[model samples]
Target: MKFTVSAAYYLLALLVCGVQADKEPLKDQSRLINLQSSRHHDVRLHCAHYPDWRIADEGDVLHFHSPHYPRLYPHSSRCGWQFKGKNEGIYFTINCQVFEMEAASGGKCKDYLSIKDESQQSQMFCGSQSPSLTVGNKVTMKFQSSYRKQAIGFTCTATAYLS
Candidate 1:
């Protein structure tokens, strides 16, 4: 059968997607979807919100400091936080938990009430996208959802593929 340029384009597209039928859509996001590290090295989960996320590791102690977030825009993930008088603190380094964030009710994040009822696993929602790690050596995750336009912005729900 004869195929025109347009047909070839669509065919090529289908072939590509067929091969990667089980991958995340927006891997282009600044956040590291799948992460890998050496046994004795630290990978920095850059702060899109915090220009700086460094903490003083004095005697290997984790610091509990605040990170000042900008104002929250309505219907924006960033809006869930930074209220006028609803108890505020800046960014914090969540060392003991794995926190992953997708597009929710707010920008980067809209509002959070802490996962306190259950295991109380400490987590940090660092705006837009959140990068999580296993804390020992290496961590890897995969994106499963296709990229789609939403009220907040473009987002993809990546499947957490562990090493």
Candidate 2:
């Protein structure tokens, strides 16, 4: 009778341990699934809106290229982005890594990237290289491609800073 009781107690202990072991893996699995779901949701949201243009906030480093950049941007396409500074004292700046677009025709870039600020004027660029540009607290950049020709596109980073 003593042996029977001891055996029963040992079996109960084993059952409890098994349940705990099973629960730990389940908890870990649940956490992993939640993390993956969150990442998938973020990607879906980004893709849904403004697939071409990327928006940047203050202190954020934005790295983007012309759609399919380094390859040819689509024929007859337009892409753009906006950069907003954190405060009135902050400004937006862009540093281009790769800037290639259709060359100028008749002294004007048929396909080019345009940067506009609050000054009511637009600065256009078309070349394999670009000079860094800084603007007010908010700036808009646009890339327009012509239907006839295309270039490798441009890669650039934008940042926000004070003064």
Q: Per-candidate TM vs. native?
A: 0.17, 0.64
Off by over 4 Å in 1: 1-118, 133-154, 158-163
Candidate 1 local lDDT, residue 91: 20
Q: Each candidate's lDDT (Cα)?
A: 0.28, 0.65
In the range 1-163, model 2's lDDT, one tens digit per residue, is 4545546556664564432222222335445432111111111111112434334444666665787866888888876776566466767677888888888888888788888876757889986548488877767777788889988988887676667
Specify the poorest-scoring 10-residue window by lDDT in model 1: 78-87
After superposition on all C-alphas, the RMSD of every candidate to the true structure, in Å, is 18.3, 13.2
How big is the RMSD of model 2?
13.2
User: Worst 10-residue stretch by lDDT in candidate 2?
Assistant: 38-47
Across 50-145, the per-residue lDDT of candidate 1 in tens digits comes to 233232221222211111222222232221111011112212222323233234544433332121111235343433444332232111111211
What's model 1's lDDT at 107?
43
